[model samples]
Target: MLGLGAPELILIILAILLLFGYKKLPDASRSLGRSLRIFKGEMKGMKDDDVRSKDPARTTPVRGEIVAPADPAAELEAEARAAELRAAELRAQAERSRTADGPR
Candidate 1:
């Protein structure tokens, strides 16, 4: 591949062997093989996900009902409740500080 003939490939391998030595070559090759396999598997999974996403009938929810917007009144009520909780916490903190300061 990439214009590398058999002679060139052999030369490259010999150079790598000389550089890394015989002891580390097997470990390097095994790590390279594992990385390549993981890369290939991830690419395959991404392609499958792409195909599934493109097919609306396969990826879309079966119920097919559109969600309605949240009620503004309900949201406002929730905010008011949160504010009340914060106020209660602040009062409790003030009471604790007053007690700690001993009648100050």
Candidate 2:
């Protein structure tokens, strides 16, 4: 719709046909149609959902700094530290077992 007319559309289609050949055009068109249908359905659903949700308080904007979610990096570092501690404990237990099993 953005300044595109029938002639421009025809030219564009011909360009695509030249690029992808005739055999693949049907599959490409089918995929494009499905995507457009899905996009249209999603937009309609969002519009309906917006209409059904009309609470004034919900619409009101918060006037403070939004707190960010917990850092994933910190969580990963904590998990790594816990794993290292567990490994150290296992090594210490193994050392004790080896010492006890050795000849006096």
Candidate 3:
């Protein structure tokens, strides 16, 4: 699509085939297709969010306490912190139980 002609396309395809071999091509193609689908979906979601944010009713009230946006990165970071806290609690509980069991 970036101005590459048929010969260039053929050469690129040949390079990919040589690098990954025939057997792995299908799996690689499926993976690429899935990635493209996910990318498209996320792009559409962002576009929709942009549309919604332009409307006054859809946005958070400015005077009230600031509401957190639905950010995936922040959610993942919070989940990771929760998991770490849970792990630490479990380790402490295990240590307490071992000590209570008296040196087995």
Query: lDDT at 86 for candidate 1?
Result: 100
| lDDT of model 1 at position 80 | 100
Off by over 4 Å in 3: 1-3, 61-104
Q: Which residue runs does candidate 2 get wrong by more than 4 Å?
A: 1-10, 55-104
TM-score of 2: 0.43
1-104: candidate 1 lDDT, tens digit per residue: 39999999999999999999999989999999999999999999999999999997557555977655458789899999999999999999999999999963
Name the weakest run of 10 consecutive residues (lDDT summed) in model 3.
Answer: 60-69
Best by TM-score: 3
Choose 2 or 3, whichever is better by TM-score.
Answer: 3
Error of 1 at 17 (Å): 0.7
- Looking at model 1, the pairs that clash are none
What is the lDDT of every predicted structure here?
A: 0.90, 0.87, 0.93
Point out the higher-scoring one by lDDT: 2 or 3.
3
Candidate 3 lDDT over 13-79, as tens digits, reads: 9999999999999999999999999999999999989998999768766796677766889999999
List the candidates ranked by TM-score, beginning with the highest: 3, 1, 2
For model 1, give the 10-residue run with minimal summed lDDT: 60-69
- Flag the better candidate by lDDT, 1 or 3: 3
**Model 2 C-alpha lDDT per residue in residues 48-99, reported as the tens digit of each score:** 7786668653453468847454688998999999999999999999999999
Clash number for each model:
0, 0, 0
